[model samples]
Target: MASEQMPPVVTLHEEYGCGAREIGERVAASLGVEYVGRAMKSETIDEIAGDADEGGFVERFLRSFTPIPSHDANIAWALEAHADHEVADQNNRYLADLAQDGAVIHGRAGAHVLADRPATLHVKLIAPLSTRITRAATEAGITPERARHRQAREDRVRTDFCRRLYRWDPRENDRFDLVVNTASFTPEQAADLIVTTYRLHFPV
Candidate 1:
């Protein structure tokens, strides 16, 4: 149990292609805690364009371009997706056990894992699909068109994982204590806002 006067812990859930990673970084920096988006992303997301030996991202399982032409193909895809989900679930459990109270954990279903902790503040980071696609494109230095393709694929897998595991709809607004629309603010500006908001709720 927490001391009654302690501030709430913070959990940041981010949509694909959003700038939540950077914002999470700045918020953690402002509040003097560890930032965590990359730890989760690098462990789960496969590096599509990098060397196999390099650890840019690890693949939980394969993703295919060939169509799921039949019922069997669909089944195979679902099994693969499930395998990945299991791996992610294990990681999330480890994350929860390792997290110190009051740490701002970004992603890795940190919100759900830390739900039992009193005064936990859950935040959702989102933007218009176009805005997020642009951000992903710029980060990858790819054309917006290609970015859209990648974003769609990422979004589908992510949505499936969350829904399958926790029955949580990432699109639902009510799940979060604070939801930030990243499209309107610069990354730095958004970060500042989050930091300010978090501080207001957790004055020391």
Candidate 2:
């Protein structure tokens, strides 16, 4: 286990199609820390270690975050408060543990999970909806219409996930230490900005 004394951590929350994964990877590379994506994946942790509730929570949480095609366009996931809290507690501990050695965590409400931790930088990446739709379409090689649909579904899901677990809105700028408008910045530029911001906030 890494020591309880943590190094600086960067937690990134982004709107759909905002290039968070790409920028987060770059930031982690620059910082020389682990880039944690889908850390909620079953392969990373035991899927059946606890009671029926724990096992069920893991399955539902995974399904809630699965890629777009598997989800219904019209239906939003209805997560239970009890299960959501269990998952939130688990996520908090796991993220804290990962940050002990420094990490850049993408999505999974990381900003909210580690909001109170010292030496943590919480960033939100977003762009205009129109810009995001275009970027998402171009990146996925999908039609604009399909991209818009997926974007709406994903954005809603992430927002609702935070509301359910943390009672906070992820889109609020006040919740983040820095909010980057990706419409004005490329992934490389955005990564550079975040790294610079982190250094400024916690100078070596």
Candidate 3:
């Protein structure tokens, strides 16, 4: 539903320590659009749940994360599945609303949520394990060994987030309009490349 008058939307998905947030900020600045980070989307969800206390998404989403007795295992599983779908639907609507104007969204499954929107670019950033571990360690001021462990945990969580909610595997390169290996480019350079591609697809 995008029009020529509206600015383009950009979604960037990256592995841990790939500088997704910084790159997304740069892209947003260059395009003069709002930059929506993963934390912002999560906060929005929390706010929604808080505003609507009971008999709504709050109870279902919370139930998805809590344990139930053995006697209610089947019922719990069903509720969990329903909760996952509800969250996905909410996320999609939120992203769609943002894309109506134009936004550079970092993480929170932006790529999957806005895949069908016109004048939108879907980007993914990746690097080898060694490269990412080194970057993560330097950024967090932690040892490479600890960074590696954190990377494994975070990667699993992100992959599962996409797979469980959207049934989309982000590792599939075909899903992205542009896939950059961040090991080869600085964050600014990556942002430049993405902006160039965006302009090409959605000329101003």
Q: Which tens-of-lDDT digit does each residue in 1-204 have in candidate 2?
A: 222245768999888788887899999999889999854322222343233333244345544544224345344333343455667788888887897889999877788778878778999888999998998888878889978866755666557667767788887877699999999998999999999999888777
What lDDT is reached at residue 21 by model 2?
Answer: 79
Candidates in order have lDDT scores of 0.66, 0.75, 0.78
Residue-wise C-alpha lDDT for candidate 3, range 26-106, written one tens digit per residue? 999999899998743323444544545333543434444553444687887886777777777878888888987789998
Give the local distance difference test score of model 2: 0.75
In candidate 2, stretches whose alpha carbon ends up further than 4 angstroms from where it belongs are 1-6, 38-79
For residues 78-183, what per-residue lDDT tens digits would candidate 1 score against the true structure?
7656765666677676666555545677766666667666556678888998889889889878889878866765666565546655677777766677888899
Top TM-score prediction, candidate number: 3
Give the lowest summed-lDDT range of ten residues in model 3: 39-48
TM-score per model over all chains: 0.71, 0.76, 0.82
Q: After superposition, how far is residue 45 of candidate 3 from its true place, in Å?
A: 17
Deviating ranges (above 4 Å) for candidate 3? 1-3, 39-71
